[model samples]
Target: MTTDTTALRLYFPISARASATRFWHRLSAPALAHHLINAARRSGIQQAVLHPIQSGYLKGEKLTHHHPEVTSMRHPQCVELIDSESALRKFLHDHAAELHKVRAVLLKCEIPLIPNRQAG
Candidate 1:
């Protein structure tokens, strides 16, 4: 049987898919990401990763210049965090007021983590 446990995933945009400034509460996307990251860490999330996006577009938004062939429009980034429920709850509590300024998604889902194997 696959042992599935509850884990929380948080996703937020870090940069715009363009050279122009995209604002999140008067801060640039990357700046906003930095602000959010600091908040997340201070709220007790142990680990998170910021990944630069290559070729993806958000729905209902204007088509971003996110084509794989385009190199100039490649600053957009996303940060992902996977952690336990208690820690996630604490983060939500801490950032409750600031949460509305950005497009942050928190998902409660199940994932099958690969078991680590060691060779002697």
Candidate 2:
């Protein structure tokens, strides 16, 4: 059965550091993707995708560096998840702690998805 309007798209703003960036040992992009994938499996949501944003800037304070040639590439990474409204809500509620661990932006949009027609 096709997903209904209850279907929602959730966007999460992540980083090169991923979810565990705030912790002592930061997570690499692949590590973070694995973490999220596992979490989704545990949460019973099948469809998810991790996206890497290229050539984007952040909206926070400037950084201070000790060395002259150590400029940081701090572009934010991202992931977008699609699921039923209820499932999305439940996932958010269940993973509140994870949210706190990472700097993220969670957005819900109600855009209807029209699948492309197959070539006959």
Candidate 3:
């Protein structure tokens, strides 16, 4: 049988220390997941997986079902940070090098396939 490979937009929510460099860094896992879910909705990909890198964990959720409001990426390492566009820009400016590391890790994530319905 031919398998269909769906396009997925994978996002990793890192600790504040890690995301400090990306202008768009402080966005929460749930918030970012919502953005990606909207992208999936536009792209017509019904299913995808999310990995919370800060905690080194994986969670399966229906993209279409996640809340659409944006929020902060609150982990022990990232609390007390403002989640604004301007704030993110300032954070990126102050921590460009460290943000690159976050990007590198995010780039390496692999989306595993969902098992067959019978097995699942």
Candidate 4:
């Protein structure tokens, strides 16, 4: 079966150094990813996943990759949140102040629904 759902993908830098304008104003605050995850949990999202990209570039920026020798470099990160359309929309609306500074994409998609069967 196919179930309709909404997917919200947020792309940002892994390091706060690269996110000064987006989320690094406060020194005591948690990383943007963690903060967003907590917000999603509180918003009752069905699922949230954080993906660390090995090599990629954000809009109008140079390509970057994770280096074993250099840990200070900023790497790309993508946070995916899947849930009902209304729920996801509400989450975005509630966090618009913070979200407006980041690159966010929302899409309508279908997820497969599997039946849970117990062996007799």
- lDDT leader: 4
Q: Estimate every model's Cα lDDT from 0 to 1.
A: 0.53, 0.53, 0.35, 0.78
lDDT of 1 by residue, 63-85 (tens): 44445665433234566655676
lDDT of 4 at 36: 87
Q: Which stretches of candidate 2 lie over 4 Å from their true place?
A: 1-30, 61-73, 101-120
- RMSD vs true structure, all candidates: 7.1, 7.3, 14.0, 5.0
The prediction achieving the highest TM-score against the true structure is 4
Instruction: Give the distance in Å from residue 68's predicted Cα in candidate 3 to where it truly belongs.
Output: 20
lDDT of 2 by residue, 75-119 (tens): 344555566667767877887666554444445555547766879
Clashes of each: 0, 0, 0, 0
Q: What lDDT is reached at residue 72 by model 2?
A: 46
Give candidate 1's root-mean-square deviation (CA, Å).
7.1
Superposed model 1: Cα runs more than 4 Å off: 1-30, 66-76, 107-120
Compared with the true structure, model 4 gives a TM-score of: 0.76
TM-score of every candidate? 0.54, 0.53, 0.28, 0.76
Candidate 4's C-alpha lDDT? 0.78
User: By TM-score, how accurate is candidate 3?
Assistant: 0.28
